[model samples]
Target: MAGIFIFSEDSALAKQLLTPALELKASLAQPITAITLSESDAEELAKLGADKVVVLTGGTWAEGFAEAIYSQISKAEGSILLVGGTLRGKHVAAYVAAKLNAGMTTDAKALKIANGKLLATRVLYAGLAVCEEEVALPAVATIRARTFLAPAPAPAAGVVETQSAEADSRITISEVIPTGDKGVDITAATKLVAVGRGFRRKEDLKLAEDLAGVLKAELACTRGIAEDEHWLPIERYIGISGQTVKPELYVAAGLSGQVQHMVGCRESKVIVAINTDERAPIFEAADYGIVGDMYEVLPLLTAALRK
Candidate 1:
C-alpha cells in the first residue's frame, strides 16, 4: 500500500485535507497515511480513514519536517506520495520531493495511480480548462483546494504512530496573520452578502451591511469596491486574482455582474442579485433577481426580515 500524507491545520476546513487523500487511496488501491502536528490531530485523522498517523516533534525544521515525512514514507512502502495544495503542503512537497529526487505536481485537481505510476490532473489557463499529467518518477504532489469532491470511504484500520525528526532543527513562528475575515472571511462563511460598483458611494455600503446583518451573512466586496473607492480591503476583493467562495447563499448588491466577477462565484448554491439594470449579466446566473435600486430594495428586505 502507498502512503499519502496530508498537510492539515486545526481549522474548520480540516476535513478538506482528507478529501484528496481518500481519493488518492481509492485511485491507487493503497492505504493512505496522514501526518499531522499533534496527537489530537492524529485522532481526527483517524476519523477520516487514514491508515496511519504520524506526529512530528515541536522543533522540527521545514527541511526537518520534510525529512520526517520522507522517513515515514521510506518505511510506509508506498511508491506515491500525495499532499494537499495548501501553502505548507506545497513547501513540504517541494522540499521532500527535491530531497528524495521525486517528480512533483502542484494544484492537482484530479489524481490517480495507473499501472503502478502516478497521474495527476490540474486546471490551467485561468481555470478555464484542465490538463492531465503523469509523473513518471516516484514523487510527491500538492493538490488544489476545494477540488476533491468527496472523502474516501471509511471503516479502515487506523494506526497511530509517533516519529521523531531526522535532523534537530530550529523553528520559530514569529507572526500569525489571518488572511480572510479580519472581521469575516467571506469565502469561509456559509452565507455572504456582496456589494459591487453599483453601490456608488461608500455611504451606500450600509445598505449592503444592513442586509447582511438581517440575513446573518458575512459581507464581501467586488474589485470596484476596493480599487475604485477604497471602501474595502484589497484582500476582500473576489475575482480571478482574489478570493473564491462557494457559499450556501451568495447575495450580490448593486453589482453589474461582469463576467470576470461572475466566474469567481459561479459555484454558489443560491445566488440572489439586486441591481437596477435588468440587462446585468448576473441575472443570467442568479437563481433570484430583483430589478430595482438597492437602496430602495435593501431597506424593504431588511424591514421584512426584522419583522
Candidate 2:
C-alpha cells in the first residue's frame, strides 16, 4: 500500500505534522512515515503515531537532503507527502515536488483525502479569499507551524530507521552568524497584542507593550510598523508576507483591519480590536471592539487587568 509521509527539520513542527498524518493514515488506510533529521524527534514521532520513523543523518544542510527525501518516499510508494511550512522546509518541499512531478500546495490550513485525491484548504490573494485545491497523488503540501496540536502518544511506538544523506556540495559554508535574541515565537503565542500604523510615534508603542505585559502576551505589529517605521523587528510583523498566527486571544490596538493584515490572525480564537475609527475594517473581524483611541484605551485596559 502507498504510505503517507511527513518531514520537518524543526523537531516540534515534525511532531505536530503527525496529528494530520495520523488522520490521513486513518482515511487512506496507509501507514504513517515521519522523516526527521534528529534522533530525538524520530523517537518522539514514533511514539506520537508514526508507523515508521526515518532519521536522516550526516546532513549539515537540511535543504541538501531534498533528493534523499524524494528517494525515500518513492521507494515506499508514498501517495502523499506533508512538509512543514518553514522557509527551509519550503525549499525542500519544492525540490521534492519537482523531482516527483507532483502538484504542491503551500501554507495549507487543512488537508484531507477525498476520492483518492489530496484536498487542501488555504488562504489566497493576500488573505482576501480562501480556496480549496485538489491534487492527485502522489501529492505534496506544506503546513505552517501551530496549524495543529501534536496528538497524544500512540498506543504503540512505531518502527525507527536511520539513513545517511549527502549535504549539497555546491554551497560552501564559511561562517555561521546567529541572529541573537529575536523575541518569542509569536505564532506559538497563546495571546498576541498587535499594533499597526495607528500609533503616531514609535514611543507610543509603550502603551501596547504595557497591555501585553498585563495579558502575558507577545507584541506583534503590522508590516508598516516593522518594515517601514522600524518600531519592531520584522519577525514581529503579522501579514500575508509575514508570520501567520492563530493565538487564543488576539488584541489589535491602533491597527486598521486590512485584509492583508487580518489574513494572518483572522483564525485567532478571539480577536479584540481597539481603534478610534468605529468604521475600521478590524471591527468586522473582531469579536469585541472599542471605538476609542488606543493610546487612551490601552492604559485603562492594562490598568483594569492589573487591578
Candidate 3:
C-alpha cells in the first residue's frame, strides 16, 4: 500500500489513474484507494487493482469534490495522491493541495519511489526538456491523460467505502451544453486522425472526417486548425495547451508536426505522417511517411480501408 489516493470524476479516467496507483501500492506494500463521485460503474477499478474504493457522493464543483476527498486525506489514508491532468482534475488537485499545504505538480508523465522519496518526471521549457524532482510526502499531482497505460486488473476485490462529508458548493451548474458528436472522449480514443494546415480550408475537413469514419477513429486537429481556422472546436485541439492523446494508430495529415503539436501525440503506439514536405518534423517522429499532399493521400487511404 503506497498509500496513494487516485481520483477522477469519470470511471474511465479513474481507471486510468489506477494503473499508477496500483504500481505504487505494489512497490510500497500499501493499499491502493480510488475515489469517484460519478454514478458510473467503477467495479473495473477494483478489478484493475484498487484495494479500496471511496465512493464520494456530493457536489459537482471543485469545492464539493475537494471536501469529500479531503475528508479522507485528512484521515491519513494516503500521503501521495494522483489525479488526471484534465482541466477539472487540475482544479480539484490545486484545491486539495492548497488546503492541505501539500506539494503539488501537474502534467506529470512519470512517477516512482526513489531513495524512499516520490520522484516525479515532468516536461519543462515548453516540452523542450525533461526534469525529475523529489516531492515531500502528502503530495498531489495531475497526470496527463495517455501518460500511462491502464494496467491489467489484479485478482482481488476492492472494498467499497462510502465516506460522506458536508460539502459547500462554490460553482453552480446552470446548464450543460455538450459538444462533439456523440460526446466522444478523445483522450480515450484508441485510433485517431489528426488534421493540420495541409487542408486548404475548413470546408476540406470533410476529407479527414471521411478518413476517420472508415478508420473508426476520433477526429483531432492541431492548434491552428482549431484556434485560427475554427474548423474544429477547442476541445478537439491536440497539443500542450490542448488535450493529449495516445491512440494505437495516429494518422497525421497535412501537419508539419511542430514540437508543440507533437507533444500531445508522441506517446501514440504507431504514427503515420502524410505531408508534402519530406523534411517535416512529423515524419521524424512517425513510423511511416508518405511525402505527398494530404488531399491526394486521404482519398486513396480511405478508399483502401474499405477493401
By lDDT, who's the top model here? 2
lDDT of each: 0.73, 0.91, 0.82
User: Per-residue CA lDDT of candidate 2, range 160-252, in tens?
Assistant: 999888767887778877652365788889999999988999999999999999999999999999999988988889998888888999999
- Supply the global lDDT for candidate 2: 0.91
Better of 1 and 2 by lDDT: 2
Q: Which stretches of candidate 1 lie over 4 Å from their true place?
A: 10-16, 60-64, 70-78, 97-105, 114-121, 131-139, 144-156, 166-173, 177-190, 223-230, 233-243, 256-263, 274-284, 288-307
Worst 10 residues of 1 by lDDT: 6-15
Summarize candidate 3's per-residue lDDT along 161-225 as a digit string, tens digits.
67565667655678978776567788889999999998998789999999999999989999999
Error of 3 at 10 (Å): 1.3
Ranking of all predicted structures according to lDDT, beginning with the best and ending with the worst: 2, 3, 1
Q: At residue 106, what lDDT does model 3 achieve?
A: 75
Off by over 4 Å in 3: 39-48, 145-158, 183-192, 206-218, 247-249, 274-279, 288-307
Q: Provide backbone clash counts, one per model.
A: 3, 0, 4
lDDT of 1 by residue, 164-198 (tens): 66553456566776654366556778888889988
When sorted by TM-score, best at the front, the candidate numbers are 2, 3, 1
Error of 3 at 75 (Å): 3.1
Better of 1 and 3 by lDDT: 3
Error of 2 at 154 (Å): 2.9
